[model samples]
Target: MESLIDKDRIQVKFSAENQFAAIEMAAKPLWEQGYVDEGFLAAVMERERNFPTGLPTRVGVALPHTEAKYVIKEGISILTLDKPVLFAGMGNPKEKVLVEILFLLAIKNPAKQLGVLQTIITIIQNEMVLKKIKGAKDPKTIYNLINQFI
Candidate 1:
């Protein structure tokens, strides 16, 4: 299996309009690297708009993602926004969240999808991991920390 992260896909944006913009920005590196199709970015955004992937952490954070087909490569793209962005809540649709860290996952295989999700779940469950990610100052730092876990 490919590693959960592709350092090439990591991005650090100081200004993002919203969560959708963040996801699109994060996915750009992957798209340019030829790891994802041209349509993958748009597809992911559409899927998310219709079916949100926000997962509320026990300590307060959300992990959002969509289907594996949106992936051009079997890797993760991470973004640390200068400001939080609102995303539809996972556990409660009525609620909204300002997610600081967005993990844009791209997994091509359907069978491997569960494994990727499990790995992400395990990583986020660790308070230290979440804290480190939240504390990360740049794309490299975030990429390094995620590499340690997956």
Candidate 2:
């Protein structure tokens, strides 16, 4: 499958005051590009409330996404923050995670969600690649690196 990642949607050196801001920033491009509907942001926020997506990985990440109804198409938005934003940990909502990377997704097909999650998790598990992404100098570099996965 062709990668849903778009270099134009990538954010580098981004800093958000909170998780909500991070998710908004990450989803904005997708929204503007018509990959997702207006309800997408609200859906993502609601979903996050019920099921956190933050992962305590090597470089702290959050994978925020909503249901297919909110998506007009499939795409992934990559946000690399300059400062870590607080997020509710995936498994333990009580635990707070300072996330530096946010993967905001718009998946029109529910079946692809699990596969996408697996792909992201696998990439994040590679410490070297994760480190490379964290230290990437530009959005292009990050986009190029992540494009390898999809």
lDDT string for model 2 (1-150, tens) is 246887888888887889999999999899899999889999999999999989998799999998898888899998989989889999899988889899898887777888888888888999888888878878889887877887
> What is the C-alpha local distance difference test score of candidate 1?
0.71
lDDT tens digits, residue span 81-110, model 1: 777777888757667877767777777776
Among the numbered candidates, top TM-score falls to 2
**TM-scores for the candidates:** 0.85, 0.95
**Clash count in backbone of candidate 1:** 2
- Scanning candidate 2 in windows of ten residues, the lowest lDDT window is 1-10
